[model samples]
Every structure is written in structure tokens, then in C-alpha cells.
Target chain A: MSFDVDIEVRRGDRTISCAFKSPRGITVLFGPSGAGKTSVLEALAGIVKPERGHIAVAGRTLFDADQGIDLAPEKRGCGYVFQDSRLFPHRSVRANLLYGWRLQPAERRLIAPELAIGFLGIGHLLDRMPRSLSGGEAQRVAIGRALLSGPQFILMDEPLASLDASRRAEILTLIERIRDELGLPIAYVSHERGEVDRLADTIVPIGLPD
Target chain B: MILSEVEWQIVALSLKVSAVAIFGALPISFVLAWVLARKHFAGKVLLDALVHLPLVVPPVVTGWLLLIVFGNNGPAGRWLEQTFGLQFMFRWTGAALAAAIMALPLMVRAMRLSIEAVDRKLEIAARTLGAGPWRTFFEITLPLAFPGVLAGMVLGFARSIGEFGATITFVSNIPGETRTLPLAIYAALQMPGNEADATRLAVVSVVLSLLALIVSETLARRSMRERGGHVL
Candidate 1:
């Protein structure tokens, strides 16, 4: 599915604007810590309402402030992996992964839960509680949960920030596999240059403001 | 060794009043806790103060206030009595209302802490995953706050079971009707040479309070474990 964004949002004292479209593959929002990368991703996902401009995924208008058509986050058909994983600590990994699927319309595509469990290499973690998962494991489960949502676009904000170097390497490779195999349009937010170089297909640098 | 018929009646009546008070206040307390923890509105401080009014006010004053608004001739009382054919004046219902008011502050405090403790990011994630506002509240927020809700209920139950001053003031000490454990003990202590009866009732109250505390703690721990959260 195609993903397009032309949005301006206020970040603290700054007014940041961005416009881009990705037909397929990963589009990395590469920048420094305070460079408004997460804000852009949040706006696209409908988590943060844009000050102006519009967002459309697969030609479906998700937001247009002028038109007064701002779809709620749930109806945007976007998957988001929060910086902290945000796994439902009360649910098992399997349950967390199945949560989004449970909310889908009955006529939606029937993607098996096992595919996500296997894709993220979290088969063994299905019954494990979120508290039992290590940082890397939790991140993997977060990715799996997002994927199981049948999203047209996936937004991940520093999904590997909590991991060690070796763990980051493992998750990075897995992300590349998800990109090549699933071909889902992905927007990744990160301050680390090394991660961007390793995983990003289209590096959308957070350019200096005028 | 055996509870006399009068003692049994008093015990049953106290339990019934406490149960009704706790059950009645639960939903309103939960909504108030969410509002206090998450929302900011005009006169929020005033609303917060009103919720904790029972805590700082003398129980006698609280009872007097309840009587003013909820007594038979009062506005709310008149409306209720006219529209619903219900009465709260100097009855067991009045005792339950008094207990609920006395226990409300503690319930709100416990629940507010729990609701605040929830990681808001999780709710955001749920939103992105296609759960609407009410659905996210029930599925995610409520389950995560289960431990806190349980604490609030236990605190309310304990507070209600021991409600005295407000209950007496609102409903008076009608044996087997408005008389709860605390009121019963107070009544016994005032009568001529009824020290033994007072002590027995006081021991029962203590035992009941201790049991509720233990149960609350146990359930809190269990909820934490079930959710894979670390006990703090």
C-alpha cells in the first residue's frame, strides 16, 4: 500500500513540516534526538493531530485539517510500535499479538497468528508474560503485535533503543527480513545513524529548519 | 460462644449496609478517579476538594450536610421520593448513604493512584491497533488498574463497616436497623455496665478490618503476578 504525508506539527518551540510519499519499502525518519522525527511519525499515525496539511494511506484520506476530516487513530489502519514497546503487561505475548487481530472486521484478511509468532521468532514467548521477556524479546513481540494488525503502514519509534548492541543487530536483521518479505511500507524513527544505515531503504533526513 | 439473636441481627444489618455502600460508590468512584488522574478542566481543584470533603470535615458535619441535601424535605430527597418512591430519611438507606460518603475519599485516592500508574503509552498503542475509546478503557486501562480498583473497594468496605459518627447523625442508633458494628459498640459502652458487650463487638470489628486488609493485599499481589508486573 502507498503511504503519503504532508503535515506540519508544532514540536515544543518549533514548527516542523514534512511531505513525502513511499509506495513501498522502508522510509526512515533519520535525525537527532530532538529533531521531531517521532512527532512526524505520530502525526502520520493520527496519534498527534497535525497543525495543517493532509495524510493519506493507500489513497484513503486519513487526515486533512482544512477539510475537517481527521480520522481517529484506530481507523487510520496504521500500526505503531512505541519507543518503550508498550506491551500490555497484563497479557501474554500471544495475547498481545492477537489483540489487534481481535479488533479487525470479520471480513478482513485471515492472517494466522502463527505467522507473526514465527516471523518475529517469538514462538517460545507466546505463553510468556511481557514481564518475563527481556528488552530484545519485548521489542520483537512489539513488532509482532504491530504486524498482526494487518496495517498498510508501520511506524516504529526507536524500537531498538532499549536493546544492547548485539540485540540491536538481531532485531535489525529481522526488520530487514520483514521489509523484503512482507513489502509493507515502513516508517522508522531513530537518532542513531548506524541503525539508519543498516536498515533504511529511503533515508528521509530531518533537515535543518529555515 | 454463640451469637445471640439480637447480636446476629446487628451483625447482619451492618454487613448489608457496608455491602450496599461499597457497591453503590464503586462506579462513581472509578469515574472520578479517571477524571482526576487524566483530565484537566475548569475548577478541577474545586472538584477535587469536594471529593475529599468527607476526609477533612468532621463526620458530624458530613452527616449534617447529607441530611440537608438528602433528607425527606430536601431537594434531592424530595425528587427521589417523588419520582422513585424511595426514601433515605432516618432509615437503613440513610445509614448506607452515610457509610458510602465516609468511605468515598479513600476509594478515590486508591483508584486515582492506580489509574495514574498505568502507562499511557499502552493506551496510545491500543488506539493505533483499532480499539475505540470505550473499548480501550475496558480492555486495557481497566485490567491494568485492577489492583488499584481492588484496593479501593477493600478500603471502602473497611471504611463503611466501621462508619459511626455520620451514620448515627444521619440515621440515628436504631437497633437492628441503623446500628452497625461501630454504632453498636458505642451504644453498648454508653449503657449501664455493658463493658463486656462493647469489648466483644470491638474485637469483632478489629478482626473484620484485619481480614479485609489481608485480602486486599493478597488480591493486589495476585493481580500484579497475573499481569507480569514487578511488585513494588
Candidate 2:
């Protein structure tokens, strides 16, 4: 699916602007810290509102400042995997994965819970609480949760930045596997050159506002 | 240790009043606490102060206000009596109303603190998962804040049982009707040569309060354990 993004967002005192189209594949937003990478992802997920612009993914308009049409995050159909896995501490891993899946309408559901759990290789940890999982395990569950929500595309904000080297390697391989196997378009945010080289099919560079 | 019928009646009446008050006020308290904790609007400060007004104001004054609003000739009382034939004056229901109003601040305070303590990120996550705002609150916010809710209920129950000044002022000290434990204790103390009866009732109150506290703590701990041992 193609993604079109042309937006200007004001954060604090700075206005960050970007206009780009991403062809189906992994499009990495590469930038240094404080360069509004996360902000862009947040805006796409409808978590943050842009001062001006329109976002259309797969030819469906998610936000349009001119038209006063801004869907809430839940209606955006864009899965988001945060850097820190924000799993509900009260729920088991399986429950967390199903949290989004169960809320989806029958006609809108594209991914099954079993498929997501199997794809992420987290079936064994289904009953375990989020706090008991390691960083890698937790991230895997977070990804599975987002996937099971039947998103049109996925936005991952430096999802590997918090893991150790070995865990990072594991997650990196999983991300590539997800991209190749699922064939889902991904808008990834990262600063690591190695990660970009290994995963990015298109690169959108962001810089600090002058 | 055979207790007189009057003592038994007081204990039963106190329990009934407190139970009714706490349970009846629970839904209202939850909504008020959630609004106080999550929503920001005009007159928010005024609403908050009004909710907590009973906590700071003397109980007698609160009871007096209730009487003014709910008395036979009062506007609300007269309306209710005419429309539904409902009467709160000189009745157990009136005592329960007084207890509920008096306990509301404690209930709201506990639930609000708990609701505030819940991580907003979880709610956001729920939203992303397709849960609407109301569903998110019931499934995520309410369960996470369960411990606080339980504690709040216990505190309200304790306060309701001990409410005397308001109950007396609004409903009067009618035997078998409005004379809850605290009011009974006061009566016992007032009557000459009833020191023993007063001491017995006070002991019962202390015991009930302690039991409520113990139950509250136990429930809180169990809820924490169920939620993966995270402390509130």
C-alpha cells in the first residue's frame, strides 16, 4: 500500500514539516534525537495533531486539516509499537494481544489472535504477566498486539532502542521477518545506520528546524 | 453475655444504615471521583470543594442542611411526598441519607486518588486497541483502581456507621429507626446509670471498624497480587 504524508506540526516553539510518499515496504525515518521523528509517527497514528496537512494511507484519508476530518487514534487503523512496550501490567500477555483484536469489528478483522501469537512466537508466554517478561519478550508481545489489531500499516518508533545488543539483534531479525513474511508496509523510526541499512526500503531524513 | 433487645436492635440498625449508605453512594462516588480526577472544566474547583464540603463542615451543620432540604415542609421533601409518597423525615432512610452524604467525601477522595494513580498510557493503549472511552474506563481504569475503590468503600462504611450528629439532626433519635450505633452510644451516655451500656456499644464500634480496615487491607493486597504484585 502507498502512504502519502504532507504535514506541519508545531511542538513547543518549533515547527517541523515533512512531505513524502512511501511505496509498499519498510520506510525508515532516519534522524538524530530532537528531530521530530517520534512526532511524525505520533501524528500518523492520530496520537498527535498536526498544525496543517493531510495524511492518506492506502488512498484512505486519516487526517485532513483543511476538511476538519481527524480520526481518533483508535480509528486510524495504523498499528503502533512504542520503543518501550506499554503493555497493560494488569493483563496477561495473551490478554494484551487480544485486547485490540477483540475490539475490532468482525468485518474489519484481518489478523487472527492465533496467527499473531504464532508469528511472534509468544504462545508459551501467553499466561505470563507483562512485568515477568524480558525486554525482548515484552517488545514481541507489543508488536503482536499491534499486528492483531488489523492495521492498514504499522508505525514503529525505534522499537529496538531500549533493548540490549543481543535482544536488539533478536528484535531486528523479527522485524525483518515480519516485513518479509507479512508483507505489511511499515513506517519505522530509527537513528542506527545499521538498522536502516538492514531494513529500510525507503529513507526519509528529518533534521532539526533552523 | 446476654445483650438486651435494644442493644441488638442498635447494632442491626447501624449495620443496615451503613450498608445502604455505602452501596447506594458507590456509583455516584465513582462517577464523581472519575470526573474530579480526569476532567478539567469550568467550576471544577467549585465542584470539588462542594463534594468535600461535608468533610470540613461540622456534621451537625450538614444534618441541619439535610433537614432544611428534606423536612416535611421543605421543597424537596414536599415534592417527593406529594409525587411519590416518599418520606425521609424521622425515618431510617433519612438516617441512611445523612450517613451517605457524610461518607461521600471519603469515598470520593480514595477513588479519585486511585483513579489518578492509574497510568494514562494504559488508557491510551486501550484506545489504540479499539476500546471506546467508556469501555476503556470500565475494563482498564476501573479494574486498575479496584483496590482504591475497595478501600474507599470500607472508609465510607466506617464513617457511615459512626455518623451520629447528622443522623440525629435530620432524622431524630427515633428508637428502632434512626438510632444507629453512635447515636445509641450517645443516648446511653446521656441516660443516668447507663455507663455499662455505652461502653459496650463503643467496643462494638471499635471492633467493627477494625474488621472493616482488616478486610480493606486484605482485599488491596490480593488485588495487587492479581495484578502482578505492583503496589498502588
Candidate 3:
């Protein structure tokens, strides 16, 4: 199993829960709008404090209610691709890609900067600031930045939801390549059934709790 | 009009005092601004009000308050002098300290506005990509907030250069020591036939202020362009 997670998160008056032990490759979290799908990823990434439960990524305990062990988000080793592509606007594309990679010990860097940039097809944007890029280009850089950081897994939160269909397809293909070639586990969030069908090795349904 | 040696010395002293006050307060202002911008606590409102007190209260009152705390006979003052061999009584350093206190409000406000404008989600994203809290702040948060920091420094400089009430009350108008531009202007105006000296000094003050504002605006625009941030 790539992920073994059973968690509950409280937002306002509502509580959201998900319990899933996902297989290798991508685990699709399928739900409608406001279904708290992103909250589940937040829990897995250690961004949201779970009300109670355990999150184990590849058998490493990220959080456990009974054991009282909760890792900081930085130590959780998650490469989160936010819905809005949170690139460091102050940085050039190449600098953004290297931000985390440089922080990692040379021995801990699993992916080469060149390889990640090449894979994401962002080589041409190395010197350009983020604002000059189109939405699709920016998203690609965001992904590459996370990938180059050498995270143990990736959490993608509706990465294609903002793009046009054609741009969506282009990124979808690139994501598929990341899944097949990089061999990193991914927990992908999406409401579209087509995305779930195309990406899920295991489908985890997330929604507001009763 | 060309400045005499004494006039030049006065200008230099004023610049030095203002520079020390602003630069000395920069890091402390950043921490206070970050706390006020990002933290939550029961006494948050009280802290905010306290930070702004120097701005609201009469500068002479602030100087009096400083005297109570940092006077040579006072606890902090005695400890600082005994431990570090430093004294702020009747010295230019005292003037700098007064100016710093007076300038602090504008500095913190400018920095807080910039920090509040930073998209906090980016910090979260940085953490998810393996950046620890310090790295995320220095790299992501600070860079995005640089323009505001620069603006704050300039505002503090202006305020410090013009700080008279607190400085005079705290350090006294000692020539070649605490007699900065404002104090010098006051001294010039006190004597008969010294109106020319006062006018020239006033002109220098205006030119310095104009230069600071121009430099601040140019740097801010450049930093904003480099950030190119639409998220802000």
C-alpha cells in the first residue's frame, strides 16, 4: 500500500472523514464541490490537524492519534501541487525549481534538476518570472518545482480544474507520464469521473461526514 | 549656498543618527510586524496599541517614559551599562534611541501591511516541498514583502530625521553629540544674525527627505516588478 490513512478533519461546523489504504501509483479522491476532498489531502500532507486518526505513507507513520505522533508538513515529504499553482512569484522559474532541491542534502536529492525540468517541458522558462507564463506553463513549473524537491509522494489537488480542456489534456498526459515513469505514489483529488477513471489505481470517495 | 564645515558636520550628524535609528530598528520592526500580522492571542489588541503608543502620545511624554526605563539609575539602564559598558544618557546614542522609538510605529505599520498582503498559502506550499519554517520565511515570505520593508525603512528614516521632541528631551541639545539637524536648526534660530544658517539647514533637510522618498519609490517599483506577483 502506498497510503494507509484514516482521518477526520473539522472545518467550521462540518466534519470530513476518509479512510483508505491505497495501492501503488495514483489514488483518486473523488467528490463533488465543497466535498472536503482537499481537506483529506491536507490531512495527508500534515497541513490540517486531524481530529483523530492515523496517516501512514508507505508504512512510515506521519500521524497517529493513539501514538501521539504527528510530523510537521516539511518532514512529511509531500510534494503538494496546489489548485492555484503556488509558484514563488519573486523567483525565476529555475530558481523556484531549485528552492527546495538546494535545501535537500545532495545525497537526498532523488531527482535531478535537469530531469525534472525536461520532464515538465519547462526548460524554455528557466529565466522567466512566473507572471510572464500562461496558466498551463505556470502549472507545469509548479509541478516541476515540487518534483525536484525529492518528496516521497505527490498530492495533487484538482490541478486541471482551472485549465481549458485542451490544456487539461496536455497536463493530464504529463501527469500520466509522471505516474508511469517517476514511480512516485500520488494521491490525486478530482470531481470528474473521467479523471478518476483515467488516474485511479484505487478510488477513495471523500465527502462531508454524517 | 555652500555649507560651512560646521553646517556639513550638522548634516552628517543628522544623517548618521537617522540611519542608525532606522537600521537598528529594522529587524525588531520586522519581528513585531510579523507577529502583529500573523499571530493570534488574547492580548493582540493590547500589543498593537502598545506598539502604536509612541505614534499617538506626545513625543515629550515618550521621552519621559524612556528616561524612567533607560535612565542610568533604572534597572535596564544600570544592567546595560554594567554588563555591556554602554550608556544612553546625555549622548548621541540616546538621541538615536529616542528617534527609533518614535519611528517604530510607521516602520511596523508599513511592514505589517506588506506581510499581510503575502499569500499565506505559499508558505504552506513551501513546507509541503520540504522547506522548514525559517527557509520559507527568508526565501518566500521576506522576498515577497521586500518592497514594503524598504518603504518602511524610508518612512522610519524620515521620521527619525525629523524627531525633535523626544530627542531633545531625552539627550538634550549637546553640540557635536546629540544636536542633529532639528536641534541645530533650533540652535541657529536662537541666536541673532544666524537666520542664514537656519535656512540653509532647512534646505538640506528638504533635499534629504526628497532623495529618500525618490530612492524608496524606485526600489519599491523594482522589487514589485521582480516579484511580478498577481497573487498579492
Which candidate's DockQ is highest?
Answer: 1
Error of 1 at B125 (Å): 0.7
Model 1 root mean square deviation, Cα atoms? 1.8
Fnat score for model 3: 0.98
Ranking by DockQ: 1, 3, 2
TM-score list, all predictions: 0.96, 0.95, 0.95
lDDT of 1 by residue, B145-208 (tens): 8889889999999999989989888889998779889999898988889998888788888988
> lDDT, candidate 3, residue A116?
85
List RMSD in Å for every model shown.
Answer: 1.8, 1.9, 1.9
- lDDT for A166 in candidate 1 is 95
Tens digits of per-residue lDDT, candidate 3, B150-216, equal: 8999999998988899988888899999999999999999999999999999999999889998998
The TM-scores that each candidate's chain B achieves against the reference are 0.96, 0.95, 0.96
Give each prediction's DockQ, rounded to 2 decimals.
0.85, 0.68, 0.82
- Model 3 C-alpha lDDT versus the unseen true structure: 0.90
Clashing pairs in 1: none
Descending-lDDT candidate ranking? 3, 2, 1
Q: Candidate 1: where are CA atoms >4 Å away?
A: A208-210, B228-232
Question: Which CAPRI category fits model 1?
Answer: high
lDDT value, residue B52 of candidate 2: 98
The ten-residue window of minimal lDDT in model 3 chain A covers A201-210
Task: Say which prediction, candidate 1 or candidate 2, comes out ahead on DockQ.
Answer: 1
